[model samples]
Target: MEILFYIVPALMIALASCAVAAVIRRSLRISRAWNSGLTAEARCLRTYTTTSGGGDSSVRTTVHHVYAFTTRDGRGVRFEEQGGPGTTLEGDIVTVHYPADRPEHATARPPARGKLVAGTGCLLAFLGTFILFAVGFMVVTYAMFSAVGDFSQP
Candidate 1:
């Protein structure tokens, strides 16, 4: 029963680390997709105002929208633009890149801050998991060894 205390925590930490790694991998994949130019006729839509919160005193926030046209095998392919904040407005054409093989795989040029935010999040998650695992390991080892000494005494 006592062994479970150590094993469970270690397993949890390992799982958390794997989850963070998966996020990092996905981000990299998206970066590559954007660079490959898979989408067509990509254009930045006009900014729209959206209401946030409830009540008359609710704050109005500006959201930038973008549109992209994708085609496959010389045929028109249906694609939708997504993402919010820091996106380019309508009539303002932004650079759109995606993989040639996968026209649907695309993304707008993300702002520097966006990249920074994602990178920071991933770093923190990784570091946090590592620290938790290390501390747990040390604590478990110390407790186990101390128990051994206690048992030998009487």
Candidate 2:
């Protein structure tokens, strides 16, 4: 339908904006943690892969690692590291950064640039969709006016 032309692009733009905002928010949080200067040597306790989908659709596998570390105060913390600098084998040692107040919320040292890249890509998508819609609207308007011929006086 003609309405879909407007609805689809609006939805795409909204989705892209949401994605970009999420990436920026996450990046800021990680930046804060990185700047906190609290760090520890974490050990990968275990590694696992989760697979989803079958039959009709292709399966997607996500790798997750559980890491344990001790804070400066000797508090032991274990958490699942998601989507960054993943370690494939158990017992691998890596450095992690965290806020003193929130030791459980940590990030791997030398944070991955994937978030930044994703944010940029989403922002570009948002801009591209917006421009495409604007040009489309203008062309449609011009075509409509041209088809109507002169209307000033006759």
Candidate 3:
């Protein structure tokens, strides 16, 4: 219906904004990891895959990983990464990065340019959708108003 034209774009734009926020936050976090001066060796404690939300329309599987590391001051930290799995395997030694003052906030080093590209991609997609919605809204409103004027011309 005509009402859908207005409602759908509003919903899409709102959802897209959330996606943009998530991508930006993730990119900033990864950028911090890459820029940190402190480094340590971490081991992948475990890796597993989980399947969910898959039905007739879509099927998806996500990989989960856990890592453990020790800082220079002999402080130990363990975390579960929620960004799916990386190339590391259980017991594999991986490089970690963290602010020297916050060794407890360490994260595995992401590949060069990976986070930037992902954030850029999300932004571009959102921009495209926004442009499309704006154009559609203008066209629909213009047509509707024109039709009303035509009817009023008796």
Candidate 4:
């Protein structure tokens, strides 16, 4: 019983860690999907006028024009692209990484390596939690039965 008190808490912690890790992995996958189908060809830096919502405010700001060169199974595909805030602009020529099996599906930026790492880590965490729970349950059950046996002994 005393041992079970300790094991139960450890099991709960491991399970909670596994849940958080899973959420992180899912977010990574979404980001990878959005980036995978983009390619870069050229960039144009110029000042453009920006407008706010219903407010009477308009501003001029410098923006970069990004052109992407996409290829689908050896066929060329072209698209005009732009960089969002906080994203690095690697000049006119940008490397696009795509799935070899599906060339049409590509990204301007390489897929994140952390996603794979996080996924593996989460899986391991879940496995560890289950193992701890199983072992603790077995130990507690055995101790309970042993106590019963001792009480009945003549």
Top candidate, metric lDDT: 2
Model 4, span 19-134: residue lDDT tens:
66665665554455454664434232322334435556655454333444545445554433333333544443556554434444444544566865676677767766666776
Clashing pairs in 1: 36-98, 37-97, 37-98, 38-98, 38-99, 45-89, 45-90, 46-90
Between prediction 1 and prediction 4, which has the larger TM-score? 1
* Backbone clashes counted, model 4: 6
* Candidate with the greatest TM-score versus the true structure: 3
* Model 1 Cα lDDT, one tens digit per residue, 1-154: 4556567767777776777777676576567765554545665545565656668576766554646554555744334453454535566665555667665656565535477557858786776868687667869776887777644355
Q: RMSD, model 1, all Cα superposed?
A: 6.9
Q: Per-residue alpha-carbon lDDT of model 3 for 112-152, expressed as tens digits?
A: 67757776787868677786776688578769866766443
Model 2 lDDT tens row, 72-148? 99999998866545445788888888889888778765655586567656776766677677557756856876798
Candidate 3 vs candidate 4, TM-score winner: 3
Q: Model 4 scores what on Cα lDDT?
A: 0.52
Ranking by TM-score: 3, 2, 1, 4
* Weakest lDDT window of 10 consecutive positions for candidate 1: 76-85
Q: State the local distance difference test value for candidate 2.
A: 0.75
Candidate achieving higher lDDT, 1 or 2:
2
Q: What is the TM-score of each candidate against the true structure?
A: 0.51, 0.62, 0.70, 0.29
Off by over 4 Å in 3: 1-4, 82-87, 101-105, 126-131, 138-146, 149-154
Global lDDT of each model? Answer: 0.61, 0.75, 0.73, 0.52
